[model samples]
Target: MSYLKCSGMCQLIGGLLLLLLAGCSAGESKFLAGNLNAVNHTSAAINHFSVNGYGGGNVSPFGDGGGMCCVMLPRQWLPGLKLKVEWETDPNPNVRLPALGTDAYRAAYAKHKANYQQHSTIVDLPSYETESLCSLKVHFLSCNQIKLTTACMAYGQPGYPIKEPQVMKEPAVCPK
Candidate 1:
């Protein structure tokens, strides 16, 4: 019985070590590539390429390394998505991950408020950004937008409003 316990402990330690080793051996510079398209107020479609998935955080400045969340536009005049990326290391900081006023959240909150109103109980209302793009566009939707909100609200993950990757204003060790 003692031998079995010892072997089990050893196996657990070995598994943990292997996981650590794999993490270390895997380099940190992984890229996330995608294409983004947006229709402007004029009803013209614009396309942009996106990259820069690693090394984003609160400390990442606007022009240093990749941002925690950045969305670059391919053209100089194309409008980008309106998003807020927030994170907290604290055990409890009351930051609304999907910041107030997301379309999905609003819809949910509206339903919740309606149910509460029927009961005559005053549930605290959620605050939201009135100027969000949803207010301007009648029909704009993306599966990612909702998914991102759910992930952030549930897991406190940060969002990266990345622009399409572009040539570095200054060149250095760029890919050929």
Candidate 2:
């Protein structure tokens, strides 16, 4: 009887210790990942965007692209969290791709490449209200401005925190 009692007590203590460890181990990541969404508010087109090496879809001006799955974020928001954003944009969104493996393709490709521009910056993540993250929304604004939101609601939905204008204004002079 005493042996059985001791075993039960030991098991309970061990279980309690494990729970304590798990709670503290939530360091840096309890890791809830969500879909990546690109929202564009510029006259140009966002060819691509990435958050800390996680690739997302392209978006058109005043529009949003399809969601890209699985951008890992800490389950709980911590102050001062930031991410590196790298993106490519095209001034002319309507450019047609020339047929591959031809002389026209090479020349057109060069021109297309010349028209494209790249941007990279470290952006502070906007605060979120919930532990359950919905999407990592990357907003590309005019004059090479970028904003990030992990808001639980979708863009343009009621109570979605990222405010947008009816008609976006592009900058007359962009920074070099």
Candidate 3:
């Protein structure tokens, strides 16, 4: 009957629309994201770093909140070797690292301070500049050994991207 055909067509169009909407929402989570590569020229070891930045101006006054940025460096290490880290973005233009350490904890702490000075503001979180975030150089023991480090900074909570979770309101229409 005409009624059955019309209903079937309407359901097909609705499904297609839902798929398109989901695709667009996928890109809405992060404003900027990518990897930074750090190399130890002396030992010929390489470390890959991943960085992420989130949050931008929202349309509603009560919409999501401030933004944050972070960097991750490789974990490879050596006893005598030091890292030559050129922080990607420095809040303070004057701060520079001429030397590196043996362990990762010390290196991370030291780099955090230098980066804070270059990119962060003393006043407010939302107003801080996101571009000054820097990449780090991870040291390694030997040519064959490699360690990958991952660090993430989020502008909002873990569930930010999926603002509204879908609810199953109706069951699928199945043949009896």
lDDT of each: 0.27, 0.83, 0.31
Which candidate comes out best when scored by lDDT? 2
Q: What is the lDDT of candidate 3?
A: 0.31
Clashing pairs in 3: 76-139, 77-140, 77-141, 88-134, 88-135, 90-118, 91-118, 91-119, 92-117, 92-118
lDDT of 3 by residue, 63-159 (tens): 2221223332223322343222221222233434445674765776577555432111111112223433332212121222222222233223463
Model 1 C-alpha lDDT versus the unseen true structure: 0.27
> Each prediction's TM-score against the native?
0.17, 0.76, 0.21
Arranged by TM-score with the best first, the candidates are: 2, 3, 1
- Ranking of predictions according to lDDT: 2, 3, 1
In each prediction, how many residue pairs overlap at the backbone (N, C-alpha, C within less than 3 A)? 12, 0, 10
lDDT of 2: 0.83
Candidate 3 regions exceeding 4 Å error are 1-16, 19-27, 47-128, 131-176
Question: For model 2, how does the per-residue alpha-carbon lDDT over 1-176 read when each residue is reduced to its tens digit?
Answer: 66556577788999999999998886556778889998888878888889998899888777887479979887777889999999998888877877998999999989888989999999997777676778898888878888888876777889877787624788678776
Least accurate stretch of 10 residues (summed lDDT) in model 1? 116-125
Give the per-residue lDDT of model 1 (tens digit) for 1-176: 66556577799999999999999888643322222222111111111112222223221111121222333222212234333322211211222444477887787556544432100111111222322211110111121111121111211124423222221122334343
